[model samples]
Each structure stands twice: as C-alpha cells, then as structure tokens.
Target: MEMQKMSNGSHHEYETLDKGIQPEEESFLPEKTDTGKKIQFNDFEGKTSFGMSAFNLSNAIMGSGILGLSYAMSNTGIVLFLILLTAIALLSSYSVHLLLRSAGVVGIRAYEQLGLRAFGQPGKILAGVIITLHNIGAMSSYLFIVKYELPLVIQAFLGQTSSSGDWFMNGNYLIVIVSVTTILPLALMKHLGYLGYTSGFSLTCMVFFLSSVIYKRFNIPCPLEAFGNFSNNATIPEDTCTAKFFTINQETAYTIPILAFAFVCHPEVLPIYTELYNPTKRRMQGIANVSILGMFVMYLLTAIFGYLTFYANTEAELLHTYSKVDPLDTLILCVRVAVLVAVTLTVPVVLFPIRRALLQLLFPEKAFSWIRHVAIAVCLLFCVNLLVILVPNIRDIFGIIGATTAPCLIFILPGLFYIRIVPIEQEPMSSRPKIQAACFTSMGFLFMTMSLTFIGMDWMSGEKRSGGGH
Candidate 1:
C-alpha cells in the first residue's frame, strides 16, 4: 500500500489511494470508503503558517466597510449597532463552518469546484460570476480610495490646496502611478501564501488608524461647531454628548446591509484554507474565528468612538467627518496616509480570489502559467482602474452590487452549498443541522429583499448616501 501525489491541475477526479496518507497530511485526507481505500486530490502545497493565514484573512475582512460602520452606528445608536454587529459576526463564523464542512466531505478546496460538486456546470458558472463581480466591486472600491484619498494625503504633505492645478495633486494621475508601482507588483505574486507579510503590514496600518480614531475622541471637544472658521467655537451642549441606546429613523434601513457588507470575506476563505500549512477544518475555522473576532472588536471600537466624537454631525465616511473638523491636523494627516497604505496593500489580497475564480471558470484543466497569471492580473487592474476613473459616482454602483452580492456570499451561497453538497444519508433533511442550514438560506433572501427595498426608497426620494462607505 502506498500514497500517491498527482501533479495534474484538473479540478475533478481525485487520485484514489490504495492505502493511508502520512499522518501530517491526515487533516485534509478524505474518509476511507467501504473498500478501505483513501481518496486524495491535488492541492497547492500549503506553506503559510497559522498566523500569516489569519492575517491574510483578517486583511480581507477589513475594507472600506470599517469607514461606513461609524455612520451605521450613528443611525442605529450604540446598543442596537452592537447587537447587529455581534449577530452578524456570529453568523459569518457559522457560514464559514458550513463551507469548511462541505469542502471536507468531498475533498474539494476551491469554492467554484464546490459549486460544481453541488449542482453542475451552471453552479460553477454562477459561483464564478458572483465571485468575479464581487471582487471587481471590491477592487474598484479600494482604488477609489486611492483615487480620492491619495491626492488629499499629498496635498496635506505639500501644504497645497486642490486649486493648485498641479499634476501631482491630480487624483487620476496619482491612482495610475500607485497602481503601476505598488499594487501591480504585489498582485503578480505566484501564491496567496506569499502575501502573508503584506497582509500583516496592511492590518498594522489599520490598527494605527483605529488607534488614531480612539485618540481623537478624547482630544476633540464636544459641541464642535463652525468648521470653516476654526476661531469660532460654540459652547458645549450636555444633550449632544450623551449616547443613545436605541433609535429608529428613515436612514435605519441602511444599517444591516452596511454591517453585512463589512463581513463579506467568504470568497477568500476557501483559498486561504487551501494554502494553510497543516490545514484542518478546525484550524482553518480557528483562523476564521480569530480574524473575524479581531475585526469585530476593531469595527466596534472604531464605530463607537467615531460616532461618539462627531455625534449628530457624523458623516457616512468616518474619515471625512474628521476632515470637516480640521483637515490639516498632523495626526489626521498621518491617519489618512495609514488608511491609504492599508487599502493599497489589500487590493492584491482581494485580487487573488478574483484571479483564481477566473482561472477556475476559464481554464480549469491548465497548470499554473505565469503568462496567464500576469496577463489576468494586469487586465483586472486595468479594468478596475478604468471603472474608478470613468465613473462619476461609484457609490451608486457600489450600492447596487453590495446589496445583491454581499448577502449572497455571506448567507445565501454557503447555506445552499452545504444543503446541496452534504450527503443526505449522512445528515437527512429533517436533521437539526440541515434545518438550520435551510433557515439560514431563507434569512439571506429576506435580507436581500429588505436591503433592495430600502435602497430603492432612498433612490426614489432622491437622497444621496454612501454605499456602506464604498
């Protein structure tokens, strides 16, 4: 009896083993059949340690969503926002559990492959399209940050205003420069494991941003009125400083979708799991748990402090709200630079899943090719840069995509995949887990419907708002 490793890149048809795999590889090994033969498949040989994997996943979770969370908290109030945040974090963890379980049952690591396992070619196509669209939206949003914020950071550093008319201050030219120099190189890496260090650096930048937010809350005085002229200040109002426990308003409809959008890291989950060293369902799940929990705490603190500082004047984007107070403040300028660095590094991490999904859909049988990989990365960045540059208002496009895709990735697909992929004999329809999965799927549809309805109402009313800080 011996264990065999096949180098073919095909997604289907595992190489069945006549005997057991080595103990180190046992975590990902398939269960032995009645014939006592083990089943194994070709996967990217994982090299990332547990910590780096967690960092990569955490960076994926932390996006422009953090910026909008403060605004969401402003509408929902402190207590209610905490409830929604806690519930969504727990549900996101559960969804990852479902994905891990489904993958383990069939020894399929790629998300699109899991889709193919469940339904057919159509499932694979649907999964691929959703992943592509979702990540495209994500990449566009990150570049949008570069397009808008990088200019401001430069202006602050140079002590020049936007009216300078200098090419260095032009956002369009700056985004292109950053993409060619920074983002494109990182995106060209051969494996997701290689990005672990960049991901760690990105998260560190975010921690600095979060720390700055907390610091500003204490330093910035209350009743902070009259921004255009800093010399004029109003007296403090006791009522304005007080925190609200619960509240409801027309803007309340946007809160859930915003929170949901913040947690849409599902596309990256399986891929990170694929590259994790000594990977197991539990260890990957631990990675997810640690990453989610860390982001949850960071999100919670950022929202609470940001909203507390601005109170009624909080804008849809927390950083923008800070800008209205004092645009040239040194610490705030540094915070902007930190945020720019974080999101810039994150573009590559987000780009990996999109590139992988495209490969799965377009070239499932092909082995790793540098020509194809580099071409895809270059093409994707070019398209996203075009989208960011050409579109006058990306927030509206971002709104529509977030409303449709975020819930699907977060709630709908995982629930549907688990129910479809898991064997009926192993866990029947009437079983507790199956029933829970069904309910989870139904909840996704409900969330999608509610988000669209509210966003539609806002459109009809002609009220402009940020799409969860996209």
Candidate 2:
C-alpha cells in the first residue's frame, strides 16, 4: 500500500490499486470492468470547455500589470511599446506551445513533473522555485494595488475629506478587509480548475476598468485645463494631447520586461491544460493563443487610452493619476473600484501555482490535506500583505520581478526543457525546434541582462537627483 505522488503533488495509492503500475503507463490505458467492457470515470474526465479555460488563462495573464502599462508606454512611447508588446505576446504563446509539446511527449500534466522528467530533482526544484518567486511577486503586486487604490476608493464613496485620519480610511485596514473577505476564501480551493467562476468575474472587472479608461480619455479635462482659469483668456497648450510615437531614454529598457510580466502566465498553463476538456497539445495551445490574444488587445487599448488621456504626465500606476485629477469624480471612483476588485480577485488565482510549488517542495509524499491547504493559503496571504504594506514603490517591485524571474519562466525554462527532454533524434541541431529553442534561450538571457543594467542605472540617477536636492 505504498503511495505515489501525483504530478501536482497530491498523493494516491496507485501501487495498491493498480498492482504496481506506473502512473504514466496508467494514463494511456483505459479501465475495463469484470465483463471486459471499458469503464468510464466521467467525474475524473476533463470537464472544462475551451471558452472557460481561455477565460481563466486570460484572467491569469491580465493583472495589476495593466495598471502600469501607461507608464510603460510613457517609457517607450506608443509605437515602440506596441511593437514590443506584440513581440512578447507572440514569444510567450510560442513558449507555452513548447511546454505543451514537452508535456504531451512525456504524458505528464504538471509543470514540476515535466521538469523532473527532464532533469530529475534539480529540475523539479528549479521549476518550483521559479513558480514560487514569479507567483509571489504577482500576488504582491495585486495586493499592492489594493493597498494603494482601495483607500482612495473608500474616501470617494464615503465623501470623506483627505485630511481625515479615521482608521476606516487607512489603506492597510482596507487591504486586510479585502484579503479576508474576498481573497482568502477563493485561495483555499484545492483544485485550480474550480477557479473558473471567479476568474471569469475578475476578467469582467478588468474589462470594466478598460472601458472606464476609454470613456475618461475624452471626458476628463487635461492637466492644463484643470489649472487654467475659464473666465480669463488662457489658451490650452497645443501639445497637451499629442501622442508620442517613439522615444529612447534610460526608462525605455524597462518597457519590454514590464510587457513580459503582463504575459507571464506560464505557471498556470500546464494546470489549465490538465483540466481542459479532451486535453491535447493542440487544443490547450488554442486556449493559450486565444487568451494571450485577448489580453493583448485589452492591454493595447488600456495603454493607448490611458496614455492619450494623460499624455506625458501618465503616472506609474494609472489609478493614482486619476485620483490626483479628482478623487470624488463618480466615473473615476467607479474605475478605481473596478480595478480594486479586479486585483483583489487576482490574488487568489496567483496563489494557485505558489501553493502547488510549495506542496511539491515540502510535502510531495503527502496527500491533499484541507488543513495544509488552508494554512498555506493564509500564510501566503499574510506574508504578501506585509510586503505590500512595506514596499513603497510598485514600479520597483514590478521591474525587479518582471526582469528576473519572469523572463526565466516565460522564455528561458520552457525552451531549455524542450531542448533537453525531446530526443536528439526528433530535434537535431539543424532542426527548426532546436534553432527556435536556442533563439528563445538567448533572447531571454539578453533581455534579463539588459533589464537589470538599465534598472541599476535608473536607481543611480534617482539617488543623484535626491542628493542634489538636499
């Protein structure tokens, strides 16, 4: 009655039930009854449809990253930003396809398991650590949104003046309330497939946020308009609403990494593939393509509209820029609330891979336990909440995580795994797959090095500016 760990870290007594059959072999064989007729397990069969899976994957891809895209556009300008975003989305979709092909070839479902099959325990640990760091960074960014935006939203709703020091007006207290009331319950789900409902709703909230941005693009007064006196004969600046198409500056290097972060949903890709109805490499890839394309459109529109509205003045977080204009504006308040809800719901979705990674690392031999699941979910939320409160700059968090772990997960690991796992006979040195893998791996490393260098330069320049001011 020895137990075996499933690819997802859940354990089942396969040795006792199947008389020492390996799980990979069992995956391909059909069950038969006493009368020799094939038996079916509809409950165990994949139940998620293409649309639902795409929605869930799309939700995973789109997060608080959208909030910073305008700032990204400011860095790279509109034309270059769009080009980089398109390239990143295409490369990301290709990376998912590589992972899917690797999984399909080995008949494995979980990402860590695929790593184990490729490079054994070290590979598994690498996959787990990358997933952990990438996901924790994501969850913290979402809560960071909650920490900064929710209090302003509460103030707008209650008509409370900014000078008030009420406990209810505290962002820390509001984020805690949101984490407890909204995020924790959803994070406790034992299976990733069950999150489709909330994921769909979360995506809807993001759509609402996008729509609000488009609406405000035309409605909100420009920065100069807010400062100008209407009774006097003051003319608005001619360049106030002009869009910048191209720019090169120190900040431009961060734009690609930020866009890469927007599309780093690889940790959830295999889990979603496993739950997909009639799961196949092609079908799961279709889901990834659809999800990535949808998010790409949403991101382009959000960045364009938000950037057009603010032009050169777009802040790192778009919502904060809105608050400065008029926190009490009804539509602006609604937009803030939509973004807050979107990010809050996103926290739980990001938690899935982190919990799965920890399970693989710590308790691979143990079966799924309700106590462990709840405790881990609570601890993760608490730790991320603390980080969100302590971290003052969201852009720095985004840049560090997006530059380092994101590229590794999105571009490097999948390509390297495919090259190693897929037989040399199937993909030789001259083969297209091998060439593509090499290109992907090289691009990832180049981007990682350049991003880190630019971020360091930005930090140094900021320090110089501060020292000069003093």
Candidate 3:
C-alpha cells in the first residue's frame, strides 16, 4: 500500500506500519513475520469507544453558547431563529463531511496536518493559529462562566449574598479553585479519549439545565413584576408574552452569528476522529451526526422554552434572566450549579485541541512528553484564568474572535481544504462536489463579513449590546 506523508510527527510509525503490518485492539503486540523478525504493532490511537466519542464531541458542541441561544431566539423570533438555526446545524454537519472527506483522501487525522497537506507550511500555520485562538477564546469563555456563575452557585448553596466577603463568593478565587482542583487533573490526562467520562457528565449537567429551563417556562409567570434591579412599578406591555413568528431589526444581524458560533466544535472533531475505535470516515461522520443532532434538540428546546418564559425580555445570558425571578430559588440554584459544572468540565475538552495544535506547531518532530503535556495544560489554564479575572467584561474581545474564527472552522477551512486537497483528477473543477465546496467557502466568507460588519457597527455606534457569546 502506498503511504501518504503525515506532518504531525507520526510519519515514521505510520510509514513503518504501511510495510504490511496491521494494528489491532491491543495496545501493542509483537507479530511473527516471514522474515523471522517480530513486528511490533501499536493500537495507541483507536481505543475510544463509539459512545464515549459521541459524548466527548457532544460536550464540545454544546457549551456556554446554549445560554445565549434564547437571546438569539428573542431577536429572530420563533420562526426565523428556527429556520436559521436548523440551517446552521445542517451546514455544520456538511462542513464535517467535507473535513472527513479531505482527511480520508490524504490519510491525515490532525487538522493542522490536513492543512499542511493541502497548502504546505502556510496552511499548517493558519490552521494552528486559528485553532489556538479559537480554543483559547472557548476556554476563556468557559472559565468566565465559572468565574461569574460559580460564585452565585456557592452563594446560593451557602445562603449567602454576593456582598459577602467570603472567599467562596469571590469569583476570582472560586475560578482558581475550580481550575486547580477539578480542571487541572482532568486536563493532565494523556489522551482526549480519557476525558470522555467527564464529558458525559458534562452533557448530563447541560441536560439538567435544559430540563430546568423547560420546567421553569411553565412555573414562572410572564410579564414579571420585577426584572433584576428594575422597579416593580414598571409595567411591561401585555403583548410582551406574545411570541413573534418573524421579526427584523438591527439586532437581527446577530442571530446568525450567534447560531454560527454556537455550533463550532470543528477543532475537537479531528482529534476525536483520530481516537475513535475502528475509526473510519463513515464512522466518524456518524458520530458527528449523532452528536450534532443531540445538541440540535437540546439547543432548540432550551431556546424555545427559555424564550417562551421571557418572551421579549430574555437577556443574552439565559441564566441571568432566571436570576431576575428570585435568585435564591432552589431550582434556579441547582440549574446554576449544573451549568457551572458543565462548563468547567468542557474546558479540558476544548483545551486538548489547543495543546495538540501547539505541539504540532512548536515541536512537530518531537515525540510526546509528560513534561510538555502537563506544562501546556498548566499554561493554558493559567492564561485563561487570568483572562477571566483580569479582563473585566472582555467578552466583546472573544465575541470578535468567535465571529472571525467560528465561521472559518465551520465553513471556510473545511470547504477550502476539500477544494484544494481533493485532487482535480478525482473530482474535476466543474464537478458537483468541487462546485459545492466552492459555494461552501463563499458562504463562510459571507458569514464572517456580515458578523464583523454588524459587530463593527455596534462598536462604532457606541451600542454595547448583549446578544450572545461565541
């Protein structure tokens, strides 16, 4: 069998394996060969079960983005948001198909390596930088959730107020504690597959949160007497509870970008594919579909219930909107705790790809080392904690990063990689696949341009609006 070169430092091993050796279920086993020499076969990469892989990918796909979705629904109204969201979800799955097809053609698992194969060194660098930036933003956003929400959770449990000077109530201190105690150890794991259990738990927590949102819709009366610090004397219009089927306004531009960013699990997709047991393009694509479909249901339910609960008054962060109706409510407190736990567990899953991308960029030829792995995890967590602690209300920064990188990951890079790496001889320029890939790439450019333009308008017009976090 002819072997394609791998750019992520596994070339030698794969090349050697190509010389008539096949990997199996065991980690390593020596095989008797015709040449009277034992051949060592390693199955280091394919240990993650199908179910666990789906859990991890599902955890990656669902993030703090879920919290912002209700706000997106509020802006676009019921009919429009559903249409846009379903479109984005389908497009996201198609994007994964493009990526898997590209990876299959080149026999490369790493996204950066696929880039290198597609466009050489520059391609590799672009993939590496985007992965780094996008994951960092994700990690920071997750930690920001911990920083802001964890304290509220603790406060609620302890029956204390935010004004309390206790260390647990301090978001900065609580975030560091969670990072060091919970996040650090899991992040130190050698492989992405090992985090699968935690990812499963994280998904469960989010499910609890979604269930709570659905339940609360029936319990909490609309046209709330008081919203946060707003006066109870303020009268909300009676129509505030009415759902809008279709709407258009300045805020309408944010709906697509919000939904686009919500579906960004591209960085995690290739890594999970590499670790899947009995890995195949079809198998990985199935995992992606299952995960995406699961999240689609969760996202749709969360948005519909959350929007129905608040109607026009839904805040960008769904949890915060809940606080407006008695922050000390036991059910709401549990929901907050669930969200905190979910986001905390997801950080390590997001961090793995960033570290892998870094290792690929900085030490492509070097073998994996414990020292390097632990160090990368530590550094990433520390930097993210700093961003959460030191950077006050810097979500706009991450918002911009998400706007730029999310679409690239979701649409542009996959489409471009497919267009460039899939040989013209196999699929000619005028072929349907190539034409579709070209169109996919164009759509990404359009998404990025529109997202940035709206965001720029917000900044230029001095409107510090809250839509959703990417």
Candidate 4:
C-alpha cells in the first residue's frame, strides 16, 4: 500500500467531530443493484444534526473582527457600516447555502475534507496551507487584541496604573497573559461542545457590553439616541431618517464584497448541514436562518454602539472608544472582564478544527489516536503562545490577517466551491447570472494572492539582504 503523505504544514489538526446523529428518513438517495451498482444518498450515521448548526451564529459573527468592526468601519460612516453589515451578513448566509450544497454532492463532513476527497492530497495540502496561514494569523491577532484591550479594561475597573505608553512592557506581559488565558481553556476542553456554554456566556457578555455603551451614551452630555440601531441605505436621502431606513446606507459595490465576506466562514457551519436530522431544504434553511440572523444582530449592535459612542473621537476605534467612555465602575469592569474572557475562550474552539485536519493528513489510519492528538495539540498551543509573546502588536497582525483571509473565506471560496462543483441542473441560480460566480472566484484568487503578498512584505521588511544574493 502506498503511504499517504501529510505535508500538512502549520495547521496542527482540524478534527472531524463525531456528530452522533440519526439519518433523516426524508433525505433523497439513489439505491444500487445487488451486484456492484450504487446506493445514492446513503444515510450518514452519527452526524450531529443541529448541534453545531445552533452555534450562535451571532457569536461566530461577533467574534474577534467584531472587537475591531467599529474601528474598521469608522470612516465608512455609521449608516453605511450598519447597512453594509446587514447586507453583507445576508450574502454570507447565501454563501453558506451554496457551499453546503456543494458539500452534499461531494459527501464530506468537514469543508476541508472536500479538498482532500475531490482534489487529492496535493489539493488538500494546498488548501490546508492557505487555510492554516490565514487561520493562525487570524488567531494570533485575536490574542493580540486581548492582550492590549484586557489591560486597559483591568486598569479601568481595578484602579491600577496602566497605559499604552510603555511599548516594551505592554508587549511582554500582554502576550504571556493572553497565551495563558487562551491556551488554558483550549487545552482543558475535550470536545467542541464542551465549550458551548462558555460561548453562550461570552456572547451574552458582548451584548451586555453594547447595552452598557448605549446606556452610557444617554448619560453623556449629548446623547446620540438617534443613532440607535439605525442602519444606512443609499436609496434614502443621506441625512433623512424618517422617509427611509437610513439614507447613508451601504454602497451597492461593497455590499456584494462585504456580504461575500462577513456573515459566514465560522468553520463549524459545514458540519451542521451534514448532521441535520431531516437534511431537508426546509431544515437546512432553518439552520442557516438561526446561524445567520444570530450573527447579523451581534455585528449590527456592536457596529452601531461603536459608531454612536466613538463617531466623533479622533480614534473612532472600538477599544479606544471604550477607553474614552472609561466606565470604571464595578459593572463596567465586570463587563470588560466578560468580553476579555469570552474572546479568550473562543481560541480553543477555533483551534480544534485545525487539529482535526492535521490528524487526517499526518496519521490517516491512526487519525484519532490519543497519543498523536495530545502531542500535536500541546505542540500547537505552545507554538501559538510562543508567537503571541514574540510578536509586538496585535492590531497590526489582526489587520494583516483580516485583509488576507476575510475575502476568500467569506466571499470568494464558497462561491468558487459552488461554481466548480455543483452542476446547474442540481442547484441552479440562473436568475442571478453566472458572472457572479466568475467575480467571486476571481476575487478569492486575488485576495489569497494579496494575503501572500502581505506576508512576503512582512518577511522582506523583517529580514536583511544576504551577501550572496546581491
């Protein structure tokens, strides 16, 4: 037997969780002859029907990027941001639909699993490499945000001295603390579901934080009550609120772009479809609705809060805005703590998938062996910690990763998967026009290239010229 090469790259492991599901009786499938024909739609055993589907899409949507959404959207305008966010989120939900449809045809549990089954090891390797680069970078940025944001939170609530002034001290202990906070939770959890309650709690804290900021605005001298939950729309007059939803809503150009990127890409959503009880178009839509709407609300609230609170400040950034609001009370302190801990808790949840993927490639037959799993898991946690400590700033890293990964994973890859895999007769969208497929694929290719370029620039700027090269 030929040995399967791993060449998994930096991705530790992206596991295929035992969904423990019962097959829906209603699903369509082809039955084969007694000889060697084929049985189609053979029901998958042990799928996690709606377990992962219920993953607070709001939580997935509201994650690390959310902490910065306000700032990212700062210049984009409040109405613009909200309107764009809403439109973008809907697009993501649709992307998920297309991607899932492709997966169903391919008969894969995990999305990356498709890359392996369809394209072969090299394809898997390439996809893994791209995903790993993007994921690790993205995860690292989250760590960075926690490091800086948490301390300010700590000082504000506890009355301890703190400042963004000391660059050295900030980076040093900040990473250590973040690594400890993020890594510990990850190491302790045995299953993804184990962290479900914590994720829920974390999400609640986020909503609470938004509420606090909104309430605080009322207490401010000039409360921007008018800005509450108001999303923008280009169709309406820029300044008028009554006639339309919000005049300054998102631009049509970026709507597709943003939607292409924003709502989906949680990594866990794919499995949800596989595990669905009935796996009906109706059930799938329900799962998607819960998943997408949940996320949309979270993003919208956070974006709006940030806009109302920091729209005028020089920074207009989320964390910076929080600092300005400077709510040092016990309640506020607790709120910051909740946000810190919630974000920190999410690290392990994200890492688990990468670990699973690693196992499939490196040890195909013995994929689930505990020894290999533990060994790799420990090593990855250690490495992430090392990187967290080594890197100086989280925001810079965060920006780089978001710019690189967000486009493809969010807008581009899903589209590409649908375009390449699903036949028109199977899942036709003839009304939308095929140009969109071309556009999304091209965009993904371009963004993936951009991510590589950004990393290449980082390498060049960080390294010195070798004597022989000249």
Candidate 3: tens digits of C-alpha lDDT, residues 1-470? 23433445463234434533332222221234466543321225478999999999999999787998888888888999889988989999999999988876656678898889889999999999999999999888888888877777776777776558877688999889999999999999998999999999999998999999989999998667765333577665667779998988877787888888888999999889877777777789999999999999999999999999999889888888888788788888888888888988999999999999999899887777999999999998998898889989886788688888998899999999999977786788899999999999999999999988887888899896755665
Please report the candidate that would top TM-score against the real structure.
1
Residue 447 shift from truth in candidate 4, angstroms: 5.9
Tell me the spans in candidate 1 whose CA falls farther than 4 Å from its real position. Answer: 1-12, 15-27, 30-40, 227-238
C-alpha RMSD by candidate, in order = 3.8, 5.5, 4.7, 9.8
Candidate number with greatest lDDT: 1
Q: Estimate each model's TM-score.
A: 0.92, 0.86, 0.91, 0.71
- Selected candidate, larger TM-score, 1 vs 4: 1
How high is the CA lDDT of each candidate model?
Answer: 0.85, 0.77, 0.84, 0.54
For residues 1-470, what per-residue lDDT tens digits would candidate 1 score against the true structure? 23345556474545436435432243455445456755335555677899999999999999987988888888899999999999999999999999988887666788899889898999998898888888999999888889889888887888876547889888888889999999999999998988999999999999999999999999999767643323445445555767787878877777888887788899999989888876779999999999999999999999999989988778888888888888788999998899999999999999999999999999998888999999999999999998888897877777778778888898898999999987686788999999999999999999989888877887898987544743
- What ranking emerges by TM-score with the best candidate at the front? 1, 3, 2, 4
Q: Which segments of model 4 are wrong by more than 4 Å?
A: 1-52, 72-74, 156-158, 162-182, 185-190, 223-266, 272-285, 314-316, 325-329, 394-400, 423-436, 443-470
lDDT of 4 by residue, 1-470 (tens): 01111345212222222233212221222233345433323234324346454653344455555555554454456566666776666666676766666565544445576666546677567556556655566556557667667667655645666564654346557756656655654545555555556667777777787777667555543322333433443243343321122333322222223333455354656534444454544566677778677777766676666555545341423554444444465656666677777667666666666675666557654524566666766777677767877766554454455556667566566676666555565446663634576666676676556545644555678741110000
For candidate 4, the lDDT comes to 0.54
